[model samples]
Target chain A: MIIAFTSKGTDWDSKMDPRFGRTDYILFYNEDTQELSHLDNREVADQAHGVGPKTAQKLFERGAQVLITGNGPGGNAAEALKQMELKIFVGAGEMTVREAYEAYQRGQLAQGA
Target chain B: MKLAIASGKGGTGKTTLAVNLALYAAATRRVALLDLDVEEPNSGIFLKGKLKREKQLFRAVPEWKKEACILCGKCSELCRFNAVLKLGKHILVMPELCHSCYACSELCPENALPMTQKSLGFLRHYEQDGLDFVESKMEIGVEMATPLIEQTLAYAEAEIAGADLQIRDCPPGTSCSVINATRDADFALLVTEPTPFGLHDLSLAVETMRHLDKPIAVAVNRVGIGNDDVFRYCEAEGIPVWASFPHDRRVAELYSRGETLYDKVDSIRTGMDAIHTQISSLGGGK
Candidate 1:
């Protein structure tokens, strides 16, 4: 599965434009499946700076089985990911994208669980 | 009349000007103050008002039906925000990532997309010293302050539409939230200190206000601290300098203690009075 990491809250990718201090979109692609998804740090809630709801959608599209970040799955973002059946792991701090993917590969993460 | 006090950079006395203006306006007219600085709203700290009402703000996100799903990936492809994802038999929606533009649901031929509301922040109203105050605080971990700022402004509009005047304490930077705050104002008070950062951001703020076609005036706080770059810009642009406050240690100390400038400096009281008069004349109000 292909997964992407976006700096936006939880919106679709087509809705965002590239602007200064608002361009936090990261995508992780699963080459085998050609799927893509994304993630955004909870810090985005402070101002909606570059974070939107599309980050979650891109992550799911890229086949992100698990999401690890500073925010839990109880807010608006969690509900969106819940609909996608993606696991949410909150308080995942300072870990690189590779570290997060490895944790997901080990089946060690779930939605706020 | 509604006046928005805005600055492009933070810590440039936007709150200071807003609070003093609100306090000064309230002395003669029924005034309302709306703080659109959701990130770090300092107007409340200065005003020291008692909370009277509070409400949560929310945004909607689409939900997908997994039971009758064909996993055709049509919804994902049609979504501009990339908020929809299809993997194997699973379809996912990320609410925080959703802008609620409804593109996914509208384009979905399968009719699998449904929308649900998610809380984004809190809108609080308070009253102190005959001034009504409205403030918004975005919930931690939820992005997208535009919706909350929009909702908060709507609430303020409903409550203060008939008032004689309203003061909006706008957020820093020329972002969407700041646009939302100042879009409907009769005039904007662009507050800035006389520093390099102040001048650079002031130019950006002026550009934004001009783009929105809003009439603007400049208020130079900490006037004697820095050079005359702001003055030169205003002179060249022909933007009126509404007022100026010298860099007084007592005024700064009062501000540090959460007091309005008018409360500390008696001369500012006269300055604010003149500003209100000038605004009234411009707005055709007595």
Candidate 2:
């Protein structure tokens, strides 16, 4: 399973970005392969409208099974992510990607409402 | 001729000038006053007491048909607004983000997505003192304004055919909504105040009108309250300053009470007459 974290940087130590639709980078961790990757979303952040829904499309196409972030997707985006059956975890906005991932592992982060 | 009343800054009295000019012109000519600020169309508040006609407005968007599923994902790819999406076997459609362009529905390979009408807003018309008042209000949650403005313009075109003048009151700022309101106009009257902030925003509104290639003029409202910066800016750009409505307590009281200042105030009557004369000349030009 692939886990995605909306982050400010490409690495795990980088701070987690709370905004799902306008995050700078979506850092990913592959469970089976143990590989790390990222998708840049800075351009999507500057879109005039529907940025949330567009960001949701990016997460869905990347085969993300889990989403870890500060605040989860907004209404339009939440609808798309819900349809994709992706698990979303919240309460990691001020933390680093590594810390958020650790919290997810320890079952500390709550599921997004 | 389509004459547009627009302004860059809010509360600069675009509605004031629009209603007053349409009223002055309607005395001797066939006139239709269209309030194109659909987001908050308070211009209708001053109209005479009657709702002659009302119509619900809707825009077309794509609807996904699960039974006709090809799972091609073409609709999602074609949508620029991201209103359509394909998640696994199911396709999701959000109508609020759709612009009603019909691109996704027409280009679908398997004909799975069909165009469906979604409620956007409402339009109303009233016959006020020989002037036809047309106004529209967008739905509360609707994000886009251009689609509804387009629909209202079409309705106004039908209602104002053979009319002597079609005066449109544009939305504030030089955004897409304002463009949709004033793009069809032959002459545009931009309303502004005398402050520096008004001058700054007035320049932006002028740039937008320049891009639209419309002949433009300016009206200074509440002349005594602020400085002469707006007048200087208009003179520097060679844009005519058509009317200057003074800063008067009576005007404020009348406006707050849903009354027009044309018949009661001498200065306002003269200002509206000047605007009416200029717009009338444009009708003869074409």
Candidate 3:
């Protein structure tokens, strides 16, 4: 499973970003390989419209099955992510990427908060 | 000549100036007053008359032919607006998100997507006090005002043949919609107040007009409230100061009751006429 965390920076030590669609960076952790990756989301952050749905599509394309962020997806973005069968969990802004993943593993992270 | 009345800040009295100018210009010329502030069109409030005609604006959306779709997700990839998305087994099309760019249908390999019309808003026409008034009203929750403004302008252009003046009351802010209003305008009347916030937005709007490279003038509304910073800046920029309206209690009282200040106030009416004469000297007169 590929779990994605919206982050303010590119590293695992960076705190989670509050914005889902306009987050600065997305940190992806692969449970199978125990590897981590990062994607810059700066392009969509500056868009005048459709940032939510466009970011959701980009996540789906990157094989993200779970999204952990401070805020939930927007209306159109939530619909698109739901249609892709991707799970969304909220309340991760204060946590680092590694802490968020550990919390997700323990089932302590909130869902759509 | 087409004159677009715009301001970077809201509540700078674009509609107030526009309606008054149209009313004043109608004395000797056929004037078309288009209220392009689709989000909150209030020109009709000032000018009351029987509705002459109304037309709904429509834009194309993609309709998929399920039998012919190959499930390749090519259409989704081609849509820049994210209006189309490819689910696991099918494609999801959000009609509201569509920009009617037709990229999905144009790029579909199987020709499964077809263009269909969707209602964007309404174009309303009213004949009020000898002026042809046209206003675009975007449907509730719809954000596509530029296209409807374009359509309304086209319709107004066709209807008002050999019109001596066309005044577009543009939406506030220097956004894409403002650009849509000022694209082909021969002149722009930038309405602003004398406050700091008003001058800040006025500078931004002036920059936008300079980029458009049209003749721009300034109208200072509610002149007594703030300092003369706006005038200094306009003078430094070499933009003409067309007219100024003093801040008066009676003007506010009249505006609250939907009354024309120009009709009741002699000074304002004369100021509006002076602005018209300036426009005429600038060769905007037809």
**How much is A78 displaced in model 2, in angstroms?**
2.3
lDDT-superior candidate, 1 or 2? 2
- lDDT winner: 2
lDDT of 1 by residue, B185-204 (tens): 99999989999999999999
DockQ measured for candidate 3: 0.52
lDDT of each: 0.72, 0.87, 0.86
Per-prediction RMSD in angstroms? Answer: 8.4, 2.4, 2.2
Off by over 4 Å in 2: A42-47, A70-72, A87-95, A103-113, B283-286
- What is the TM-score (0 to 1) of chain A in model 3? 0.92
Sliding window of 10 residues with minimal summed lDDT for model 3 chain B = B81-90
- How well is each residue in A1-113 modelled by candidate 2, as lDDT tens digits? 99999999999899999998899999889999999999899987556677787788888888999999887888988877777868899999999999999999999999995
For model 2, what is the alpha-carbon lDDT of residue B92? 89
True contacts kept of 1: 0.30
Minimum summed lDDT over a 10-residue window in model 1 chain B is located at B79-88
Candidate 1 docking class: incorrect
